[model samples]
Target: MKNLNKLYILLFAVLVFATSCEDLTEINEDPNRPTEVPVEYLLTSAERQLGNRLYGGFDNVAFGMTVSQYWAQNEYSDETRYQFRANTNNTFWSDFYTAINDLQEIKKVNTTIDKGQQGINQNAVATILQSWAYHSMVDIYGDIPFEEALQGVDIPSPAYSDQELIYSALIDSVSSAVAAIDPSAPGFPGGDVIFDGDLSKWQKFGNSLLLRIGIRLSDVNPSLAEQTISAAAEGAMKSNADNAAIQYITAQPNVNPLYVSYVVNGRQDYCATENFIELLNGLGDPRIGEYFVPAANTGTFEGLPYGVTSAVAAGISRDAVSQLNPQVYAADFPGTLMGFVETSFILAEAASNGWIGGSAADYYAQAITASMNYWNITDGNAIGDYIAANPYTEDNLKVQKYIAMYYEGWQSWAEIRRLDLESLPAANLVEIDPAVNFVDVSNILNRRLYPQDEQNLNGANYQNAASNIGSDAYDTNLFWDLD
Candidate 1:
């Protein structure tokens, strides 16, 4: 009887121990946090972050809009007057790097979990996005971490890469990515927000981006530029349907950047600049009404002069200056990354340079027509008349390009620098208030200064880059900016 009772006790103890062990394991697992996230979720997050960085934030409002002279602040004109802050600079740098990191992770996971053609398709998309993010950073800062970037624990302090070398790598990466994508392959169906898993559109986007990079190197390496542009022109974006854009939802977190900035924040800081308005109005461009609302008091479109002092701006009535159109600030407005119109313009430039087969004038007219249509100016006669009035001269090409790039502030600023659009800044400065004579209008910023954190954290590499690029100043011209 004693032996049987001991056996029973042992059996009970074993059961209790097993149950407790299972409970312990369950408790150790966290429901609130995830060790690994789906690559689809990561892609969505990256797209949203990129949109926020490009379309919203101080970087867009202060540096992009101000430098482009598309919009000017009612007060606190430091950013508009070419005064950059370290905090703002750091924000732009960090945000883009974060998005790039997310893209890299997607590539890693897609390689691990997916195989064959599907894996190739996923990786190609990630590579294209990574290329774009890197290009934006390189264009803004001149030199940045490229080869060793997004290495996680492997490279805590990556060295800065040369801008020219970085551009070359980006061009190659994008070209390879475009080639790797197979439209027939199975795609990660829900992952793509921009094109909804359409591999062909992604291919077109990559090719269009290639064209942009190719043209960007025209002045520095004309032969390579010509070769690259010719190849890209064969498969680039064909029409507005292929434009790379992020469509925002009319909801809390997914609202458009302009809506978050203007509506949710209730900030009336930015108004259309006279520089932009005058250019459109002078050309009788129909996009003027589409881009801005008529002033509240005057019941007509008016704009504040760019780079004005606070006192000069204060004298003007706020109600008389044109604010951005409400439609642009709508929650569902799509945030454009690259557009078909831009591709058309690039083709026009390539034609003019004799790098491609098309007639420059025909490409120019197509580009203007595309731009007008993009802004909802669908009238055939109106577009034809505008095209007729504005001939395909080099000046007209540059001017129309500038006008077409209304809300695309950073690109506009870069294009002005690359093309040396003398009239853009020159004509605007002539109208500057005499009382606001402190700023040297002749020395407009060519590039943004490196964030102060780079100096502190990556001291040696930062110093080397600064030395290579000439003082890390805003006035320093990038390698491609011959002007």
Candidate 2:
């Protein structure tokens, strides 16, 4: 009996020792802070990041709106003068790649575990978003680390791919994404913040994005442009219902950046540009009221002079200049990634370019109609009258497109650069008062400077890119920007 008791004690001690070893092995693991997560969480993050970065804050307000001359600084007018923050370039580059890397991971995850039609749909969605992010990066930086990007330590110093090559790949990627999308299948399980698990809308958004991408090559590769645009228009966003936008709710950490910038932060740094206000007033455009608020002191829709000296900007009272409209800075304003209004304009341009079989005038009218409807201007008479007044000349279509791209600063800036729209910036104001600390606004920023971090960390590759692109200056134009 004593021998039996000794054996039992020994077994119990062994069991305890085994349990302690198991616990020690799992000491690094934390259930609350998981290393691996469902792809749904990643989708939500990537979509949100893309929407915010493209639609507002430094990318939109300072770089896009100011550079596009839609808005100008009321006090510090340096950004309007083409003197952008270096850190912003770094942040913008990082923001895009981070979202893109997350998207790539989603694709990887889908391939590994959920290898079914649902997984295919998820992967397709990821590919479309990745293409969009890459397209934006190439559009801004001209040449960027693609192909080899997101390879981790395998290729830490990835070579910058030519913008032309990058665009070609993006075109293929978008096409594949569209084809792969099975709208009938379950998508993303949950956390699809943009369209709420609607794969059909995702397909349409992809095609619309593809359409925009094709139109961008109109100047550089017309044949490819025609072919791609023709194919994409067949499946592009048909109405406001199909628009790809992130509708921000009145919640902490998820509110629209415009609200955070103008309301929460209580910043009065920006005002409507004199050029923009003049354009609106000249046309009697109703969107003027939709876009800007009346001057605080004057109660008139006055504008601040764009690209002027800081001294000149400081002289203008903040209360005397029109700030962005309240509705724009409202908590619930949708941050549009791509919309029917934009796709309509793209179709119009394609039609005008003889790339597609549609009436340019009709498409142009539809674009204006879409824009009006989007802004809650639903009167039939008002819509008809506006469309009629703005006919379908090439210049008219481009100008109207510019007008419609009010809040989407990046797209506006891209259009401004692509079309070289001299009319919008009023002679593209050359080095305003050269005697003062001047930023050369003569040539609207052709391309953003490469991130300073790239130079420091990826020095050799950065040097090669700068050399290959013929200097990393703002004057360096992307391949598509060439006439």
Candidate 3:
């Protein structure tokens, strides 16, 4: 309905028709099965769906939900080895294929390879999206269909690829295709509902993501991180406007994921982690005001530390503790899964490694600044004072970044896992007890397990992947998240 040059779907229909016209169309002579749709219509759907996918897509729910990023953070609890191992939400791989299929159709429509041209930009976005979709598939499933993916009816059970190779290809494709966007050219704008066909913004988004890739390999391959950052800086998102994102409507099907969750209505079943609130409150970070609404008539706003015990529950009423912090979960999901704030944090980490053209400290400061600004917390002096007065350290740097990324469940979850769940001294908070014996609490949180649908659909593959994972709930690490 809301097509910002949403052309992905039209292209998909065309491919479907052309491929099935001979065989399928002959049998099912009703005439609507395989049909050619306008390229414009396909692009509009692509743009529209991209916005949808960015905010907790099926792939996201599959990965994030399985990983405890979805419930544990909301429940303020931990995962058992079993809970994380055979999670029921593993149906995301199928959903990702759904996205890939749409994106590939869009790419096929723009078969031309003219750089700086409208068709090329459209194709480039599709390429970048394909790389992201594929990267996510492997990131969640370890090794998955890469080269032979999205052929749909072409290849039913495509062979999987190595995770490392998939990621490596993703890194290359993203940089190359994104860099292909020509900022200084007249372009068609219909297929670009997200950015109004602004090629420069597309370039910025690509670069911002490249910075993300650079930081992802920071621990695993430092030299690779350096090289990725150096190249990404060529067109990185310098300002918030360049962020590759779309604002969701508070109304209807476009509601934010968190917005739907925090609803008192049965649609949501999670709450904020005490760990998140206490850290934000302790740092006196202004974003907290923007994030949550504190207990009514408490006389002051306060958040319990990570892993709260009733004894340390402070003076708040019991009801508030067991529920989603009202201060944070608005009726709307204005929160972002990916955006300038996320990219800026990635850049901060990259800059800290001296990978790009700025001081680590400056980038870190700006990262926090972007977080605040994105949240509409515009007191520049307050943030400036916080940066000037506070000492910069690698730990605190990541801590603030961690706090800023709270709304982005997967990113924060990934960061904490990468950093060994060590709580930085950046915030003044008490120690987290491994043995938390609190009322209504079950266990300490850890990784999300493989989801259930995987068993029913990709049963054998899921079983094999699960066997390769370790047994420890709190200690297990992904290939890239290894200590």
Best-performing candidate as measured by TM-score: 2
- Sort order, lDDT high to low: 2, 1, 3
Candidate 1, 1-483: lDDT as tens digits: 999999999999999999999999999889877677877888888888898888875877677777777888877776676666778778778888999899889887876674789888888998998898888887888988888788878888888899999999988999999999999997666867788889999999999999889889999999989988999898999999999988888998888887888899998688888877777777787899999988899888889988788777778877989988888888998888899999999999999999999799999998998888888899999999999998898878888888887778888878888988754552342234434544444445678778888788888888988998887876789899998
TM-score computed on alpha carbons, candidate 1: 0.92
Worst 10 residues of 1 by lDDT: 426-435
Alpha-carbon lDDT, every model: 0.84, 0.85, 0.58
Candidates 2 and 3 compared: the better one by lDDT is: 2
The alpha-carbon lDDT assigned to residue 381 of candidate 1 equals 97
Per-prediction TM-score to the true structure, in the order listed: 0.92, 0.93, 0.76
What lDDT tens digits, residue by residue, belong to model 3 across residues 9-94? 78888888898887775787666744654455665565445444444423233235323232222232332112222432443445
Superposition error at 79 for model 3 (Å):
7.1
Output the better candidate (2/3) by TM-score.
2
Comparing 1 and 3 on TM-score, the stronger one: 1
